[model samples]
Target: MEWSKITSDKTALSLIAIVFVIFTIEGLFYASFLGEDGIINDVDYTIAEEDAQAHWDEYKAVTVNVDNLRQALDNGNLSLKLLDEDVSIIIFESDKADGYYRGYANGVAANQAEFSFGENAFSCYVDLGTHSYQIAPSWDIVDNKMIYAVYMTDYKKEEQRHEEYPIDPLTFEISNEDNLKHNISIEVFNPSSSLIFSEEYSISPGEVIVSPDISEFLGKHRYVVVLDGDYEFEESATVARSTGLGSSEKLYFNFINNSEYPMEVGIEVA
Candidate 1:
């Protein structure tokens, strides 16, 4: 072969190799940002983080006082009150059952203290005389808004109210109308905020499942129920004693899987 031709061929091959490496690197960089659906994964994640922060900031800006708290309580909202000074409130994420301490919001003075909380669970502790009493209250987040309240309530040392109240048997009926199997979790907490019962079940399509008579063993009139699954329900419920002449009421939940890809779950409560 001619010397010049040989050199030219080598140069062309080097150029081709360089171009191939450049294209390979570019393809990998593109794949790293884009998901299988051609959507930018990193951008989506950043957007989600921004939205969550916005919600957190909005919640932190809320301040609860005496009047609104009473209105909320009258509207059947759950709350924990700090009637005196030097009371401390601890907030935790709903999914955490191990008492993961997130942060503290203390109540200074009386009902004039400013209070704010994120869309999480709340536990308040007050030192009454020499005894320190603690209560964890149930809260709910509905329509991207927190539907709970906190305020102050007067308490006397003579109350010494730590006993559990007697309640009727409360039953939960869940029916899966979806074509897919779902894993369900039920957690029941007593008035003292103790997790008395926790159970998990897998329900098949078109299956109806009834929880064991929870009050039969627990026997607490007022309880907090936290439900979780591949679908959605009330998520958290504070069940109070029924005022009717009959026994405590039963809760019915219907779950349906409406979407195939994203697993859209529709819950109907009757």
Candidate 2:
């Protein structure tokens, strides 16, 4: 097996083929025989609008990504409808639901300001006096994340301001434009208020990020990030992780705190 003899094109082709064969065998062996489940990173899930609509029940089961819902309501009410792309998310405007309340957009606000959706699976409350037509999430566990059914109506015909950028599905990032000093604390909790994990950090200047891992835990989980020192702002997020074995994917959660300025954050899952 001299190196010089192996330099021929035929010999090189044979060596390449042998290496490919070994790799193929190794892949097959692990894929078929491995017992330890890990994260899924090998498969590509492609969604076609028409096909997705036909299988509405299956689409919502994929993951409870609220950003898609929020994005569907872009321009406050510009695209407020059942989107052709994501027909699984059902949202409609109705002055019904006897016990339900609406968020007042303007004029004389409504006296009522709370709603429980999906047969009490979730609940939400709105500030009745304010012109902001907003309702907080009830933190119901939906597909592994806290969820809220925000019933927004433009009573005063005022536009609902949209976020400047796209929401991230996994990461929480805050920009410190003024280089404000702040102490940040992040905590993870279950629906029952039981704490799962907590950590603290200090941001100097510029941008700071905290990424937490919730993939190890089973079912739905919540995360709260607070900035108590120097600045004062708090943010929270939710995640539903797949903890099954033999998976090729993993996930976690983290948070950040900013001073007086509003924090623009998104979640990202890798």
Candidate 3:
């Protein structure tokens, strides 16, 4: 040994080394014995498990019944009870229904169509003896009221046969300018709500229909038009306003019958 540089307390140094070793071993044991993420409380773990169970229970409660689909098919109107929930409907024959859904002036009656419901909406096709049309109800269901129902038939041939006329773009603009606005909120209550056409945009002071062309929206629309704020409209603006706004007047549209046979009028707006 190099005595000149040797320490006087070798025993003390050994003791210090032993103490360091003991601390290192204890730290390793603490880490390994704890949870993989270093969490070791049983109660906290149990709470997480319970929360997962609750989520599963809620999901099961909301699951839709397939029988409701069958009921829609059996009923020509694709009906549902407003007992306590909102439902969705989808028409099986979309192409055939689309023609009448848009309120075509064709003078032919169609057959009652078929439909199915999903999580929150309902849609159907109306058959007026010779034609099939699409109809979608509103997303919401109000108890005891058949609002937002879409009917796909000529107004002149239905049970409530009325005088039918072409929906003049200028006349429509005048009738609804008071309520149409940039931002709109709509609430539907019936299967035919799909027939209603309404759009809101905050582009200016009033509302406007995004697409006013007849070919684009031909079917019956079932929708509630809600303006974002109270508005005062002038006569000049009436022609420029959207389809869902204007004076608080009831605007009626007509479907001209030009097809080969007598037409049937379907109910969708009311």
Candidate 4:
């Protein structure tokens, strides 16, 4: 009886030992196959996330560049005339938002301080949408005026007649009957900000004088005519200065003869 009991007890112990081994193996298998490796498997997943982040950053950069380019095109192609006291730019992005953008001439002052426009006349605007920023650029002139042909030339002291000059005379006149004056000065400039010529002269009222010496000023150059009086019909004068990509070096007629008599005129190339 004792021997049988010992045998049974040993057998039971052996069975328990086998079951424990099997459970240990199963636990290891579950940890390796299901728990550790199953959650995130691909070796390249981290790299993929990095690549996706790079691509997203590039897309954002491109979006910003496109926005800036759009603004530049709008400012370049469309010339805004500030006849009204103020003009506003819509900043709601779509009409659904409540924000507003504002713009005005704001009267030009000599800039002694930062954020000030320096001795410059600019058309200014504000963006109230994403940014509380200001947009200011050199102003331009557009108004009602007749077109006249003025001649420009370089005169050689040796040659008395217009036929002697080598360069072809530039003979386009700006017509402004109201800006009648006793004295007139004509200027021509090149894209390089070089002054081609600055000449002073006098003309009779209601007279269209073709410069006897016109051959010198005609070339691939922009011309400016400064007369000494106000326009006949309008109290203000219009000036179109500088022809370039952004009108960066542009100026407009700011001189109104507040003086009782006429003013002397000079030309500058910038």
Q: What TM-score does each of the candidates earn?
A: 0.34, 0.28, 0.26, 0.21
- Report the C-alpha displacement of residue 32, candidate 2, in angstroms: 48
Tens-digit lDDT track of model 2 for 101-167: 2332222345333333343233333333423222233343322444322233333332221122211
In model 1, how many backbone clashes occur?
A: 0
**Quick one: best TM-score, which candidate?**
1
Better of 1 and 4 by TM-score: 1
Instruction: Estimate candidate 2's alpha-carbon lDDT, on a 0 to 1 scale.
Output: 0.31
Q: What overall lDDT goes with each candidate model? A: 0.35, 0.31, 0.26, 0.26
Work out candidate 4's RMSD over C-alphas.
38.9
lDDT: which candidate is best? 1
Q: In candidate 1, what are the lDDT values of residues 1-23, reduced to their tens digit?
A: 11111011334434422100000
Order the candidates by lDDT, highest first — what do you get?
1, 2, 3, 4
Q: What is the lDDT of candidate 1?
A: 0.35
What residue pairs clash in candidate 1, if any at all?
none
TM accuracy, model 1: 0.34
What is the Å distance of residue 242 in model 1 from its true position? 4.1
Better of 2 and 3 by lDDT: 2
Better of 3 and 4 by TM-score: 3
